[model samples]
Target: MLAELKELFATWIAAVAAAVEAVMDRLASRRRVVLQEIDGDSFTARLGSVAKGAGLRPVSFRLTPHGRPEPPLSPQWRAALRSSVVEVQMRPDQVLFREVDFPKQAADFLDGMVRAQIDRLTPWAAGEAVYGLSPPQPGPHDRIVLMLAATARAKIQPLVDLAAGLGAASISGVVTVPADETAGTTIRLFNTRLAQAGRLAISIPRLLRGLLIGGGVAAAASFAVSAYLGARLDTELQDVQQRLNQRRAALRLNQGTSSAELLLTQRKRSSASSVMVLEALSRALPDSTYTTELRIEGDKMQVVGLTQDAPSLIRLLEQSPQFTRATFFAPTTRAAEDPGERFHIEAHITPYFGSGS
Candidate 1:
């Protein structure tokens, strides 16, 4: 049993090492083509190394924009470009460069800090742009300054798709500074890898559309279920309202003498109901203010309250459509015994149901 277990472990170890070797080989052996965009749409293609800083070969092959067959590709050139990593270099004019200074503590979170400010720094949101940053260097006042390079994704996506159509293994997008700079600065904006660039671009949109369609279906189903359950409750409420209207109609028919009834109706119209006055006060008072006592008589309402700012309550009540002519009935006072000032406020209650009197 021990010998069998040992053999199994050896097999697993071998498999793991083989996987690592495969990944390293893929990284080391991948050939790169740097497409130097010229004349706004055309590119000068040159072969480059996967090794860092080896740079592109000096020999140049100019390729025209799509939809033109000015120079046909030889089978050898087609084979060379097939399944190679393509690097699309944007001209300095195509990119927007901005210098930003951040506190030294933000070094580790530079990506997030820059992303949050992308909208402020450029015309596009973070998600809508392909962007990169220079290495942070010492700046004034214990800060670090980093150069941000960005361009609209829409502007470069067509170029990416063009490379992918040529059977690229992966695609990398970059932008460089003008030759006048002391040192050439190249910032990589985006990368799509794993010899799947072509299929990936098509699949991403399909995936996003599928997710949206599924979410909409789920929301509709939930709404239907809730509406089904609430139908009976809505019917019951309608029935209750109908019975109330019938009862009021019968009471009006039974009331004696039209003149006497008209007098009572006039009094009712002028009266300030406690419920309405309380609701009005509740709506008028600030969240920090609370009343200890409330009184409603005829068209007047008086509220005795404790508040952080007692004087502001008068203006608040006066501004409300439910009350008018609001003022202080008594002095607002502060005492050591209480946490807030005690206030006596009076406002005339408007009898208009939905309209200000």
Candidate 2:
């Protein structure tokens, strides 16, 4: 159970970090616009300098939430259209887009759907963005598109409302250029202007045109995947917590278990015995050798010091009643930091039997 909790914590942390990184990536670029669906087959977008000269092309695809690409869309999704759609003309190195529209009801439905998806996107983003949609047609299969980030919505809303308030015709949909097409253009732009930092992620749609095309199986798969991932995450978290707790328990076991009163009684006796052993070992050491570092684990002692002769040090340790076996782990050596030789030795002290450790 403890192990599972720890794993859950780790996964949550990782997911949050991923979410933050994605948001930061967007904010790190100079593009701060997004496309949003307005009402049936109508949408709006903020075209930055890159798309200022580009044109739109017709394509079919599905729109999905960030991170979770498999979330289910409403069955009525097929009848919906983007609120903002645009018609573009491209030639040579120049491009231009003109907005278009669809039925009001369809456009509104699509706008709501897009909004819901953005709201649910994880690792929530701050600031506003715009989302533009493309005009779609009734096809033999369902179609979906990648919508813009919700963060971009806030930034674009005022302009959109202002345009609408001015009695301008509703915008018909927008499109995003594929990253592959933009390849390195952004990089060059950034290098040329080091002060520029904003997001430029494209929001291309992944349309699944046609209704009833794998409708049942695809829906089932989404449910299955969500359930499986949720369950697996829970199980993993439990396992990790359990392991951590077990490790903690094992470490505590090394101290041995006893009642509080008994533990206190044993500690006093153990302390005196340790002091006596150290004093006895110190007195027996050779006059020419000095103890530098001493460590005791159980009945084993590791002594590090320097001596005129290694053999003489061994003999002196052997003369102590508390010590039994003496071994040299490393030969005496001179250190660069200090102009003196150092020796490392190991020995086992005979614990007085029947006395509490």
Residues 36-94, candidate 1: write the lDDT tens digits.
Answer: 87756567676776463244333334444442213554555556667777788878887
Candidate 2 C-alpha lDDT tens digits along 35-115: 344432233433433463244322222223221112332223211212212221112121112222334445437655654
- For all predicted structures, in order, the TM-scores are 0.44, 0.24
Q: What is the lDDT of residue 164 in candidate 1?
A: 59
Q: Best candidate per lDDT, number?
A: 1
C-alpha lDDT of all candidate models, in order: 0.75, 0.46
lDDT at residue 42 of model 1 (Cα atoms): 65
lDDT of 1: 0.75
Report the error of model 2 at residue 95, Å. 99
Q: What is the Cα-based TM-score of model 2?
A: 0.24
